[model samples]
Target: MANKLSQLDQVFAALADPTRRAIVMRLCAGEASVGELADPFAMALPSFMKHIHVLETSGLVQSEKSGRVRTCRLSPDALLGAEDWFQQQRAIWEARLDRFEAYVMKLKKEKEQAAAKRPSRTARKKGS
Candidate 1:
């Protein structure tokens, strides 16, 4: 669906940045105030807030403001859509590879059989 793809696009785009990815990783352990999350990064708070905005837009994170502090948490099912897509792709590729392997084995067996039916060089030389 268009909506699903849009969400996927947003999620991937947000995660494409290492800073945003780090914020997401930190949130995985537990929710934290924006200040706490920004503490580990060298960027300015405003710059870090930009990354937070992307994460929120992607629906991978949710933030709540309590007094002057903003806290962020990983939204439930943050990566579920991406994970499902990867699993589907893996299954498709694995099936294709298995079929290719079977085709290759079949060709090898046929080649061996054909070689077996041919005369050896020494036998041909002796006949000539």
Candidate 2:
């Protein structure tokens, strides 16, 4: 469906950034406060927050504000769609490659059989 495709697009687009990817990786271990998430990067908090915004928009992350602190967590389901898409592509390519290999092998066998049936130059010369 169009909605699924749109979500896939958003997830891929958001993960295209290394910063955002790193954030997701960190969140995989457990949820972290905004400050905790921002600590590892050298960029300003405001700039770092832009990455979080993108992640949130992609549905790859969710955050809750408690008092003045915002904590973020990874949404594993968001990644499932992308994973399914990749698996489908892998299966299709693998099957196509298998068919191609079979075709090549068949051609090779035919050529070998044809060569075996032909007479050698030396044999033809002796006959002449």
Top-lDDT candidate index: 2
> What would the per-residue lDDT of candidate 1 be over residues 24-106, giving only the tens digit for each residue?
88988999999999999998998989999999999999999999999999995868889888999999999999999999999
Give candidate 2 misplaced runs (Cα > 4 Å).
Answer: 121-128
Per-residue lDDT for 1-128 in model 2, tens only? 99999999999999999999999999999999989999999999999999999999999999999999999999999999999999999999999999999999999999999998999889999999
Give Cα-based local distance difference scores for all models.
Answer: 0.93, 0.97
Candidate 2 Cα deviation (angstroms), residue 66: 0.9
Looking at candidate 1, the ten consecutive residues that score lowest on lDDT are 76-85
User: For residue 40, what is the lDDT in candidate 2?
Assistant: 93
**Pairs of residues at least 3 apart in sequence or in different chains that clash in candidate 2:** none
